[model samples]
Target: MIPATSSTPPLAELRGIGKTYGTGEHAVDALVGADLAIYPGEDMIIEGPSGSGKTTLISILGLLLRATTGSIRIGDREVGQLGERDLPALRAKTFGFVFQGFNLFPALTALENVALAIRMKDGKAKDPEGQARALLERVGLGPRAHHLPADMSGGQKQRVAIARALGGDPPILVGDEPTAALDTKTALSVMELLRGLASEHGRAVVVVTHDPRLERFADRVVRVEDGRIESNLPRLAQAS
Candidate 1:
């Protein structure tokens, strides 16, 4: 379903999405008629309790999982029906993901980590090292470019992870529990960095986290309970 009001079309959208595990009497409905729209330059937060199905929702949004019903629309295309061969390229181009764990190689330096991501995402990357350093600098880690993850503080290591996520400049940045491992202050710092990416860099930031402290940074806060979007703050944030 297309958004009715036209400020900007959604970068990605979920329409009547549903996901079920198993079948028959043993089936579990992880998501039920869930719908959402992600827009550029917006910071969206998805928060829910342990079994609220937020993770399944995000997995589908990132193209890592397919829905049993409805559409997963990215830009002008409906990706739900796309074949496996067609999904990798589309997922790579549309979203950059940041996992709960930093997910960096212990041996790779900050610069190397980002550079490797650039090369992996775009095999034809020109001057990968140069681009990597610039990304590190963008995340305020320029001087630590050569340092390995073990040598850096938690915040610094998370910065490197964020820089790596920016490699291909995907329109959407998806973070799953991005700050779960950090201390309070450090987590806020990392969240601020993410907020800047949406506010200053015009990238759509979609974060699935249970931390209530992070709510202040979002333009829209979506709460999922019992597999449905219970509420979306500031109703005008998107076209329903």
Candidate 2:
């Protein structure tokens, strides 16, 4: 796969990673010996059929789940073994998350939603409203700041979600099917915004998706199957 460009260590590193669920006969291997280095300045895409462990890998990388085997290094910290209590704080400081479903608070306005995310990330926001408005404007949602989630279109809501995810300015941005709910044109626009998070903002990005449209924006394409990495190679050329 295309490696990170920086001379320093990777943004996130995984080695000999494996995960299993349950025990004995009921146990199922969900990931196997997955080695990867996600770096800033690159957009990485993980594509595979259902049950390929794509979600599991992202979970481990984002510190939402710990691997049963192997090590995960973020900066100088070996966080693979950190306890659940410690992980939440680290995850809040290190990762920004977006999902297929726009997970915005129903009762909160667009501005309030993003501001809440910012507050959660740092435990304090000097001016949450101002920071939230700026983020909304960045994602093309400034005019919709006062609107509630129900008042916006699917695309608009996702944009608000994106703005919220950026609230922390976390080092790594992880997306699980960020574009799955939108139309072709809207999906492209959302992907464009996601791509900018890597290339423009220099945050490492990893996305798990089935959409081929995302292939163009990716610096590396990884395919997984039956819980193993089938291919971990860079694309010869990206689509237009």
Candidate 3:
């Protein structure tokens, strides 16, 4: 295991970030002058209605999409100017992603899905089956590790997705509407798992969601409207 650094900087920082699509009269600004900071051990929820730029922001933060303007720093590296070739390496080293649909491969079992991600990072043919099993167990999916995604419940699939996201042990975890498809109870369980990843494991977790119940799970809530931040508030001290 890699030793934890005593004085690591913030996991991610975005300054004056802006993203625009198209040109001239057809131009649409998805994000405008947005700025944010995410620190280790922090759970942040970005809340917005449709077209409010929550997805756009997550993409930028995850290094999947570039900002048209402003600077973004992931740890000590400035990613705003990195070439396309450099992004895969940086993404593999620093970030993990969870999607709303779970995005698990149909042919692969839960364990294999996570093992694939671990393999991507280490570039070794060595089986990551044991590591994947440990991760599944951590997320309360130990018994389902050998099951294909189709055999699992909605909540179970999401749990497998979470385990896969953490398989590489990346410092920053980004989720795009992870609970959009779950029932209330299952959604709460997923949120609890994400909270544990941030608070207990010291990962910076950013989630995009419109579910009001998530307000209880987040340390900070950032509301975005019209492609800009409308408000950023820390949950009441007692709430956490």
Candidate 4:
């Protein structure tokens, strides 16, 4: 176990992280001593080919996976040793996630979907419906708040997903190939929305994608290859 420190104040930190699958001769190293730090309002893009541990890194960062041998910290809290039951609260309070597939309920309206996330975080919060409606409006989905996922277009569905992810007002947003099925223009629009969330709202946004065009919207682009960070570079900010 790595020694815990109290100096660093990043939103997320990974130190000497390593993950392996299988055993003996069949062992596959997914991550090898990977270290990363993300601060608030940072829009980071992780780029790499398939099977390069990009997803593994995102899963660990999002608290969905544990490192086999390393320390992970979210804010000042050390999460590398937390129990499974404790993870949900941390995830709900600290991070929002948007996936390639819009994981919205087909039968539920957009408003309901967003409200469900809020209710999951705080079952006793009282007026979750009203809060969800406001979030939908904030995401420019007010007109279609009553429409189900089936009734919305791909972009609209993604927007609704964004709204749902923001239900708890998390400080960090994690997205995994969120633009996979969208057209180039739509993908750019989604990237813009994510960037806006980081810059305008001061949320740390981390995106894992293979799209090179997305570098345009990233504040920092960290390329991963063979379970390691090959390069990390900063990019010019897009004008609002």
lDDT of each: 0.89, 0.87, 0.87, 0.87
TM-score for each predicted model, relative to the true structure: 0.93, 0.93, 0.92, 0.92
Clashes of each: 0, 0, 0, 0
What TM-score would you give candidate 4 relative to the actual structure? 0.92
lDDT of 1 by residue, 1-240 (tens): 113366788899999999998999999999999999898788888999988998899999999998899898999998956789999999989888988899899999999999999999999989999999999999999999999999999899999999999998899999999999999999999999998898655689989989999987788899999999998764355535
Q: Best-fitting candidate, measured by lDDT?
A: 1
Per-residue lDDT tens digits of candidate 3, residues 1-240? 111453556778899989998899999999999998887888999999999999999899888888899999988888856788999989988888999999999999999998987887877735688888889999999988889999999999999999998876888889999999999999999999998888656788899999988988888888899999887656664355
- List where candidate 4 sits over 4 angstroms from the true fold: 1-8, 236-240
Q: Residue 36 lDDT in model 2?
A: 87
Q: What is the lDDT of candidate 3?
A: 0.87
Per-model RMSD to reference: 3.1, 2.2, 3.5, 4.7
> What does candidate 2 score on TM?
0.93
Q: How far out, in Å, is residue 211 in model 3?
A: 0.8
